[model samples]
Target: MSDRHMICPPKHVAIIMDGNGRWAKARGLPRSMGHRKGVEAVRETVRAAGDLGISYLTLYAFSSENWSRPEAEVNDLMGLLKAFIRRDLAELHRENVRIRIIGDRTNLRGDIMPLLLEAEETTRNNTGITLLIAFNYGARDEMVRAMRRLAAEVAAGTMSPDDITPARVSASLDTSGIPDPDLILRTSGEERLSNFLLWQAAYSELMFLPELWPDFTRETLIHAIERFQRRERRFGGVTAPSLAVGS
Candidate 1:
């Protein structure tokens, strides 16, 4: 492989974009302004990831729990989503970015579903970076859905109970084709998974940054990548070579 291809960049990186509201409040601006700025950060991050050779970038866009927020906020968020797709779809397609969404579609607002579907269909054939958006997603809910599918298969006599395995379950997830993330980052000083990729993130390196989502820049992303590179990932095993030092 060429040096560019051999560079040790994570194959997949997932980010939880948090603290838009906090960022706006701190600046005495409307939350909507913060969300608007966050979109700019998203654009920059996507470009940086593609340039860095990261193959997959999954962003936690909106959780299912976010529906419980005030109706006005939800409407504004939905509007932003629609605007993003309408405005950026052509650019993303030209850049060869494949868009994928992982979340329940049932009961979605009539107009919203079509936009999400359009984004996926338009970029389905792209071979460049895959941008997986976790909209209306919850990790526990995803697990339950996967388990239910497995149970149905077993009940139909097509598969036995013992035939179920971790691999099978993973294949049933919305992210079946995508590789698991090597790094999962959350901004704004929060340090929790917040129900994102619970099964796939079993071994992901976590990074929590103090910078809010709107303030995240390319440098911040580079720093996070540097931090990840400095760590040793043993995948639940000790480093064999290191163990021989004292012998």
Candidate 2:
């Protein structure tokens, strides 16, 4: 590690991988090809995260809104996801990396659900970096689901509305055990959260890059972290006295 990387690394990092269709369009290739290449980016980013000593890495793989796409495209995405898990699960497990899926799994296709469950179950005891794939996820939907859990408890007389603190609500979330991402990054130069980790990104440093997902590299990851380390995160508090002139 160089002195450049000696800065404190964030405990959790999340990425919104975007622009697959655009990448394919620009390359005159099928969108499916872009998605396949994006999978390669995913593998590289995961390895980069581990090398950077990040404890949790969350990837916005598939959103609930993504189901609205054409059936063929959706199937292609599903197939790619399955291929990734089946091909890489063993290697990831051997690396002592724990796999976690954070999203709505209740309505997943029969074939996809088992693979996700198996991935999690297989590496449940690993004591290393956690890779959280957010498939079928939308931040609003996540919050809604978390709210429903609390509401059900209230209805059952196990809790009251007044007891619903931020901490309590967080515990009801799908990412209950995971820390909030300290850095949230998006690709393709898009500057939007796009319903990813809204609840969990209260204080995350956001970064947007111009590179398409398929073109992402470890160098991009390093550059982002270098930028992240230069930020002075106060988390909505004053860390020191104001030094502004004429204050």
Candidate 3:
């Protein structure tokens, strides 16, 4: 590991990239401009994560609720997504960053689905940091979908209801192969999870930053990570007696 990553760095970091619209509004610019700038931040953060030796970085790019946005705004967001993949895919592949998508793909628009699939397929063999994009994703929806799959197994006599453990449920979710996030950061001073990774973030150290998504830079990411390293994660257990009480 590099000296820069010697701190107790998190193995997986998930970010809720928020406040793009607010960022644009504050600057008297169009929301599309904010979104475009946010994409640049995404590229920067990915490079920073790789440099820091972080294994997984999940980005909450778009939620299922975002579909309710105005038609033109939604179109703009989709166009940005397409443009990002087309422009950055080869570079990401060359950098050995594997792309993974964790979200509902059932009813995705025909044009958008192929781009997403291509990103995954092209980078499937990469050995570097895995970039998980949560598009059209909602925590509740993910849980419900996982439960439905388990329920079907029970009905089919392949698994018993009594065998339904937390591990089983986690394995059934869209993030089956991915590790749960060790830290979750939400930009724009948001202090809530906002329906993100509810099941997987049971013990994630959360950092709510005042910076908008478009303003998130490598330094901001490092600061959040340093904050996470300062936290003592007990994961429901108490620390050792020597470490528990203050001396």
Error in Å for residue 51 of model 1: 0.9
Pairs of colliding residues, candidate 3 = none
Model 2 gets an lDDT of 0.92
Residue-by-residue lDDT tens digits, candidate 2, 137-203 = 9999999999999999999999989999999988989999899999999999999999999999999
Evaluated against the true structure, the overall lDDT of model 1 is: 0.92
- In Å, residue 7's CA in model 3 sits off its true spot by 3.5
Candidate 2: pairs in clash: none
TM-score of each: 0.95, 0.95, 0.95
Expressed as tens digits, the lDDT of each residue in 1-247 for candidate 3 is 3335455568999999998999999999999999999999999999989988899999998999999999999999999999999999999999999999998999887689999999999999999999999999999999999999999999999999999999999999889988999999999997999889999999888889999999999889888888888888899997778766664
What total of clashing residue pairs does each candidate reach?
0, 0, 0
Mark the regions of model 2 whose C-alpha exceeds 4 Å error after superposition: 1-7, 243-247
On the 0 to 100 scale, the lDDT of residue 102 in model 2 is 91
Clashing pairs in 1: none
In model 3, the worst 10-residue window by lDDT is 1-10
